[model samples]
Target: MDLDVAQVRAFVRTAEELHFGRAAATLGISQQALSKRIARLESLLRTPLFLRDGRGVSLTGAGQRFLRPARRTLEAADAAVASVTREERPLRVDVWGHLYAPTRTLAQVAGRAGTWVLGHGRDLPSVTDALLDGGVDVAFGRVHPPLRAGLTHRLVRLEPVDAVLGADHPLASEPSLRPDQLSSGVLWAPGPLDRLDFLHRFADRFGVRARTASVNLGLAHFLAGIAEDPRRFALLPADVPLPEVPGLRSVPLVDPTPLYAWSLLWRTGDGHPGLDRLTMACAAEARRSRWLEYDPARDWLPEPPPGSTAQVYPGSTPGGTRADAPAP
Candidate 1:
């Protein structure tokens, strides 16, 4: 009997994610639709591919054996399609974490990275789904782990972070402040602490208290909120251009400065030429601008996935390497 490519694709994604809700989201389909596809595939095979329980979904023995060939089948199909339509479309790239302004780094390499389309994603999960669904070719932002299988990422930059506070705040006059010093004030975030991974992690690590703003309008509005309360402070990358928000001051966070990590992510088997050009451009820019420099003794960074190491740019020494850094 012939197999349906869509049904096979659904199984592969669900097997990779092991969560119907997330797998469905990645496929841009409803959970019910995804379940129906998986059920049809299993029915055709006359065997159960997945073992479902209250805890979660997991691949059965048959599924474990089918996964490898399924992925190969999908890759082959993708390659066949790419051969005919690849050149007809420009590479599509997307970014998340707009509040942190991921474009600041993308703009540095866009000119030399070749023709492409840009899109915005709500966050990493949404972007990852788009990548898996072939909705986009590449993505940039902070990539936190447990990233699903069938994807790969490379650390591109580690931006120095600064503390933003009201000009009249007690520590605002200081040339540089330590992470611990910020414990005295509230850590203001653009959204909920659980949703703002970087800020939430920062607060937990540094013993600083974090509070989310009711609404996130934009940079100016967010910073203005901090300026209104002397006890309020926030963190931003050193290079983000601040709007004309009076009484707002950004001071370097020292005694272990926080470094925001940026990474480029894409499907593992994608062979798009634009992917190579973008990676090369990012590597060159990182080298020319020293974007990956890290001094563990003087800098603070979130821990990377176990066994994962930072991607070293050409001409850079191991001493300069950082752990797989995630984004702000």
Candidate 2:
């Protein structure tokens, strides 16, 4: 059990070369020194590993079995050394989320903490997958899947969403607008598939298939669509600030169907002072009231606006069978 590795190497080299001088040369030792090392190894092992003959040597059955295990022991020892070296490096925490929203908030939180980097995106699934795989530290998203390994989630915000339109548009003049009214006009609703269903149902309600003019995935494109074009409007989530587009206005989307409720997620068992503080700040922002509550619900209005294309109620959204509504 305590045989020296140097002794094992001496035994193997001599076995391969079958000559004292050649084995000594291979080991960078004199022949007498190598012979002495081999002798000590045989004694420790309590058996002659090689039988000396007139011109060469041969291994005992025990020597052959021992050769295989000795080679494996050397390999295992080398790997163990390499693995421990990697453990000495600093911990790398990878954070991920919406490029803009979390940037302002998560940074003010994570920066005060040490050792991490943030990756940004709107693709929730990819971000979540990265988090599960230990590739990302945390994600800000509208939807999160069921909990599994290495993940801990918290509801961050019940993200409010709004539908916007040009102030001069025919529909904007109504106390409440129906989706069918905009059927003939081209639609300029934004973002990807998750939110696109709202516009789809809006079109379906009218019985007229509406043409989507463009898919504006970025914030600037969504705002610019409203500011420049009198005919275009976009529905966006609440976290995004309404741009002060001079001729534009936004209305609460009576979604007919609600989509994502934005939230934040992280790995469990992590200890960081900075993130904990930031989480509290975000909670405060959530606690503060926002725009949608201020808009008068149609039900609460005492008198309906005259010449209205649709009946106005102050407290309620339009609620007939929206046959045109699309599944979220």
Candidate 3:
């Protein structure tokens, strides 16, 4: 064949993402060069490979016909080349401090995927570097890494992060808790980097008048205080079903803004098949579970500091860490 192996490899990637921009990024080539390679391949193969449109890109029949064999050939090439490079690279799943629950959930679901969730300690600059360098397959927390670089961004789920408090607390009965209601009280929160500053934007919206004091507060301490005193509170995803510690309740914020959102991420290059497959599986399962809060009236958990790492509630498994995990 007149076509080069790189061209064939580009064809395979382009077919999968169905976009030249993504295909080039994944292949780590200029889009113009990638296009020329495809064009050259079309000329050599004597067939139109793609149907480009203003909306996006798609494949022609000839391109579709070549897809499978091209993929197999390229994969085989990688396998052979990988023999020299094939070391058991640890799967470092990136997670910042704010994403404790999601990280835990991913660990549970990735039981069969040879997964290890690495806590990145909320440093996005270094974390983003690790991601692009293939040091970690995924990162699950708030990040504003520059776009237009090699990346594929996908919003996994926008959870309504909120604070859970005891029902006996004065603000618990209100339609939505105000910041001022929390200002006079202790807060359970994460470190400075993990704190959701956007939540403060609503302080003005709801006339709550609140601000974070101990920015380094951990989740474990936050929950401990809430568990010990009815007056203490902690900000959390409204969907989290905090386990019963002794006396606690979940309060939704009148604020519609999400405390923060988590995303599924990978390098701009062609993500490992296994990584994409596993991540998509976890995200789909997470969406399916909905992770709803059971009831605030149960009264089992206490508020602790944002630095809290202790499992306030056990989940629905035989050995769940959550004391409130559903009976097996």
Candidate 4:
């Protein structure tokens, strides 16, 4: 039987997410519409693909068996279309903040690949949308899990998260600090749900009472919030410039330190020659970068707090590394 590509796409996304709400949200469709599509797909096959209970849905046996073939079918279709329409275009990459490491690495790689440049997505959701819509070829950013169904990502850099504060702050003089030590200051955390979850998870691991102040403002305001008050601090990736402004300084966090993963992601089956070139550059670059030697025993932090309101990541295993690409 011929399967509708749209129905298969919905099925794959739903199976990967196992939550209609999240899957529907990612697909930009209503939950009821997604459910009807799933039901129709099941009707055509004469087999139930998922089993729904109070907790949520799980794939049925037939669904489990169909998963691989469905993925292959979608991939083949994407590749066929790309091959037919293959043309050279400047690859657009998404950049986050003043993270120079990724920028430098991308330049080093993409410079050899004719033309490519950094572009900005309005926000993380927009970045995901850009990737799905083929507006960008690759991205260097945080890879929040239950990732969009058709993309694959791997950690390119692992940097210890640090606290940024005014240099005159009492804690700023310390070379390194523990979570308990940071509890003294009010933490200025991002108001975005994903970022908030990460911050809370970080706080929970060390069992620290972080008096966090939510900031919906952009980075400038967020940093300014910390600078205005000596008792305020913000978490930042290590690569952010020290003394971001003249008065601010970044201090390392230790004694239950949690490393923030900076990842490189792209469409799963994208056969862009520029992407292939960049992948090679990435492999070469990873060999020289310090982040490649992550010791899970030393780097891994404790799980999220007992009563974490955040949704736990569905799959424990990250996507498989491609044979030609660098292992992240």
Candidate 5:
């Protein structure tokens, strides 16, 4: 059956809102018009997309199944339009933190092409979503649980993390930190729980409680936190070039130091001309730089402690038993 982009858009908007009046208002259409559009979509598919009742509207099984693919189609449509209309806009590469490796690589790629832009995600998950949604052509992030399918990433680097401490703090002068030494301070890692879960789980294994606070992935927040309280510490990537903050220091974590495995995430089937060129450039750059190949066998941090609060991912070593780590 032939598909209608208008009808598909109406269905997606309604599916998101789950309320006909709200969706219609957001779509700038009358309720009757919106209803007709959805009806046309249902007719094309020969299925009831939603179940309507006094309680409200809810997606039927068919609607639930169609929602994801429909969203992808809409995102693609938007991306295509933007690419054509916005000639002045440079292609964007999204990164979460202060990592320059991806930028450096993409800059080399852009030199061969045209101008490119650098975008930043609040955390790993957001950057991953942006890549999938076509908001950004490429991203630098950690390969962890619940990564979206149909996406591919290259292991660019394994970043040794540091314990950020206030300059006057007693342990600030220490050459490196151990989990035991950091236990006294409340370890404040930035970003949402999901993005930092690996660090949390690893720290839990060593009896250090790592707490997370949602903040913009920028240097301003990191410096402000340490300035407010000397005891506040954060786990940050060591390899990224960070501007020296007067009152803060980044010290390597020892005694089973945690590593942030960085990767270049991009949609596998996306065939943007720039992305294709960027991918080739990135591969050549990675080959020359000898980017670190993450080995699941030995690269994993110690397993989560028994009965840890967070969920342990499947195909992982729980409580120190060896298991094949998930492939990146």
Candidate 6:
């Protein structure tokens, strides 16, 4: 009997997420539709794949055995489609954390890279789904932990962060401020603190109280809001071009500078030629600009993936390791 590709895809995604709602959302289908597909696949195989209960869902013994083959089947189907459909299309690249302007880093290397298209993802989960479904070929953002299987990422840059506040603020005159010095002030965030992973982790690690704004108009508006209140402060990449908003001041954060980590993400088995070109450009630019330098004693970064600092490209050294990472 022949297996249905769509049904197998549904099963694979459901196994990965372990939640019908999330799996359906990722697949851009209704939960009922996903359930129907799974049911049909189970009927075809004459075995149960998932044990569902009020608490959650778990893979059955049959599911555990079918998962690997299911993933291979999906990948084979994708490869078959890509062999003809992908030849003339440019690599589709997407990014998240637009507030931080992740494109700035990409812009530096794009001129030297291959032809591609750029898009924006709502958040990490949205971009992750796009990557898994082959909608996007590459993505750039802060790579948080517990990433699903069949995906990989490379640490490309460790950008220094700056603290923005009003010129009239008490600590504004200081040449540089430590993380603890700003603890007494409010940490202004573009959105809810829980949704902004980097900012949330920063505040937690530094013991700073975070407050969210009702809306984010743009960088100028956001900074102006911070400038309006003496107790309000925000964090941004040092390289982000600040609009000349009156009373706006950006001061370097010192005594363990907070570093924003940027990483490139893609599917594990994708063989797009542009992927290599983009990664090579990242490695070259990273080496030229010392983009990956990280000194644990003098810099602060959210926990990174295991062995992420060794190099930016395979068999190539870009020097992000602590031993060779000099202070920024």
Best by TM-score: 1
Model 6, 153-231: lDDT tens digits are: 8777889999998988889999999988988888898888777888888888888874666477778878888766789
lDDT of 3: 0.56
Q: Which tens-of-lDDT digit does each residue in 96-201 have in candidate 3?
A: 6443466655655676555455754555566666565444666666444344365554444345656677666667776665445566665544444233443443
Per-prediction TM-score, please? 0.71, 0.44, 0.49, 0.60, 0.59, 0.70
Per-candidate alpha-carbon RMSD to the true structure = 7.7, 19.0, 14.3, 11.1, 9.1, 7.4
Worst 10 residues of 5 by lDDT: 315-324
**Tens digit per residue, CA lDDT, model 5, 1-328:** 7788889899998987999999999999999999999998999899999999999999999998888778778766776787788744455777765422345434545666555677745467777766765557777656665667868765444556677788877799998777678776766666554456655665676666646464754665555677566777877667555656777788987655665655567777665556555555554554555444333433444332244243323212212211123323
Off by over 4 Å in 3: 1-90, 111-121, 144-148, 166-168, 173-189, 192-195, 202-205, 215-217, 225-232, 239-246, 254-259, 290-328
- The lDDT per prediction is 0.82, 0.52, 0.56, 0.66, 0.65, 0.81
Top-down TM-score ranking: 1, 6, 4, 5, 3, 2
By TM-score, is 3 or 4 better? 4
Q: Distance (Å) between predicted and true CA of 320, model 6?
A: 15
Q: Indicate whether candidate 1 or candidate 4 has the larger TM-score.
A: 1
Residue-by-residue lDDT tens digits, candidate 2, 1-328: 6877787778777765777889899889999899888889889888888878896787888777677566545434544655777432222334333422545444434544444455546455566555544444456654433345656654443334455677766566655444445556556755443444444554555454545554555666566666565666565554556555566666665523222333456656544333454455444444443211222232211111344343212212322211111101
- The segments of candidate 6 whose C-alpha lies over 4 angstroms from its true place after superposition are 1-88, 304-328
Off by over 4 Å in 2: 1-117, 144-150, 174-187, 191-217, 226-231, 243-246, 253-260, 268-275, 288-328
Q: Write down the RMSD of candidate 6 (Cα, Å).
A: 7.4
